[model samples]
Target: MAATTALDTLIDLTKEALDQAARLLAGERRTQQQVLQQLQTLNQYRLEYGQRLQEALQQGIDPASLLNYRAFLGSLDNAIERASQTLRQQQQKVDNSQRLWQEQHRKLNSYDTLVERRQQTVMLHASRAEQRASDELSARMSRNGAALLPPSDQSA
Candidate 1:
């Protein structure tokens, strides 16, 4: 029982650690999602801007305006690239956190299993002891009852 208490405390600590890992994973995933959303918005804006640029060129746009559009689009591309890299890093962090949480959960489950087995063993021993005592009492009662019975009356 003392050992069980110790294991129980360990399990609780492990569970807490697991929970923290899960929360961190969630936060990482959220950050990754936000980055992806930003990437998507950038792409959409780039596409729309490109379409506008084509329309403007068809209407005889100035050289300076076209150069500016190209430079800005290039900058948008760079931003998208950086955001994608950040998203990938965040995803890796999320994966690592998930693995950590899984390990902690497994450890806690193992402790719980040990405690259950220990309790079962204790119960089995108690049951056997009770059975043995009951059997002894029954045997003694039988012997006493036999001794109190009347003796045989027939002569040899």
Candidate 2:
């Protein structure tokens, strides 16, 4: 019983740890998704700006205006690169969090299995003990009943 109690406590602790890991993993995934969305938005904006620059060139824009557009496009490109790097870093974090969650889940499962086995063992022992007691009681009652009867009646 004491062992079972200890195991139960351990199981509870493991479950809590697993829950925390799951939450962390979820948060990490959300952050990764947000980063990916931001990256995608940056790419789309860059593409549109490039298209606009091309249209302006075809229209024979002034040199100064062309330079400004080029400068702005360069800055946008830099921003996109940074966003891509950030997305990669965020993806790594998400992967690490996922592994941690999986490990915690496995630990919880192991503890649960142990607790289940312990409970089964205790139940089996209790059932065997009860059976033994019942058998003894039945034997005792038969002996007492036979003794209470006359010898001729007992034989019958």
Candidate 3:
């Protein structure tokens, strides 16, 4: 029946949507964790470099001619900090996307639930309709049988 086919299609679509949501959730979670780990690594590098710079200064390093040292350190700090910030932004974006996915998944589940409820209601109505039609047919058949019987051949 067309109704059966339509129901199957709806179920398939819902399953696909759920599958995509799960995949997106997994990928985004993985990416977020990776970014966080990268940030941690960058922080470690920055701290180590900072300590090295401090030790270099303490070792009578010429601050005047070592302008390149300061420049390199500054560049490293800026690059690392900027990368960390960008990663944080990306993490937030991923989190937002994940939230949207959750919302969409919830809405899809709600829609599926509504569809199932409607299907049950429709099946109930169909059962009642069939029962009514069967009853009408039975009544008509009984009437026909009674009329066809040899009622006129003998008085009750």
Candidate 4:
């Protein structure tokens, strides 16, 4: 019984740890999702700007004057595009981390369940053994009753 109680306590502790992990993962997932969305929007803007610059270049617009026209703007756009790619890579890493955390949580829960089952089994065996011992004692007493009976049969 004591062992069973101890196991239950350990199981509770394990569950608490699992819950905390879940909350942490949720917060991280939210942050990563926001970053991912921003990256997507930036990538789309980069594509649109590239097309606009290409159209201007085809019209015999002096590419040198285009520095004031769109060259500086193009540089800024390319920088943002590179930043978006970096963010995407970081978000992918975060996603992988979240998956690993979830898998670890599941494995811990499974182990906790196994511990509970074994504890219960141990308690059951202890109870059964106690009952069997009691039964054997009762049977022994019944068999010895005749020897302890009164001496009435000797007088008759």
Query: Which candidate wins on TM-score?
Result: 1
How far does residue 83 in candidate 2 sit from its true spot (Å)? 1.2
TM-score of 4: 0.61
Candidate 1 global TM-score:
0.92
The digit string of per-residue lDDT tens for model 2 on 1-156 reads 787788888888988888988899899889989888988998898899899999999988999999999999899899999998998898899889989889988888898888788779889999999999999999999999999987676555
Candidate 1 residue-wise lDDT, 104-147, digit = tens: 88988898888889989999999999999999999999999999
What TM-score fits each model? 0.92, 0.86, 0.64, 0.61
- Give the worst 10-residue stretch by lDDT in candidate 3: 147-156
Model 3, span 1-156: residue lDDT tens: 676678768777877877777787788778778877877877787788778778887887785736867787787778778877878787787787788678767867877786789889999999999999999999999999999987575545
Q: After superposition, how far is residue 10 of candidate 3 from its true place, in Å?
A: 2.6
**Model 4: lDDT to the true structure:** 0.75
* Residue-level error in angstroms, candidate 4, position 70: 4.9
Better of 1 and 4 by TM-score: 1
lDDT of 2: 0.89
Question: What are the RMSD figures for all models against the true structure?
Answer: 1.6, 2.6, 5.4, 5.3
Task: Give the Cα lDDT of each candidate.
Answer: 0.90, 0.89, 0.79, 0.75
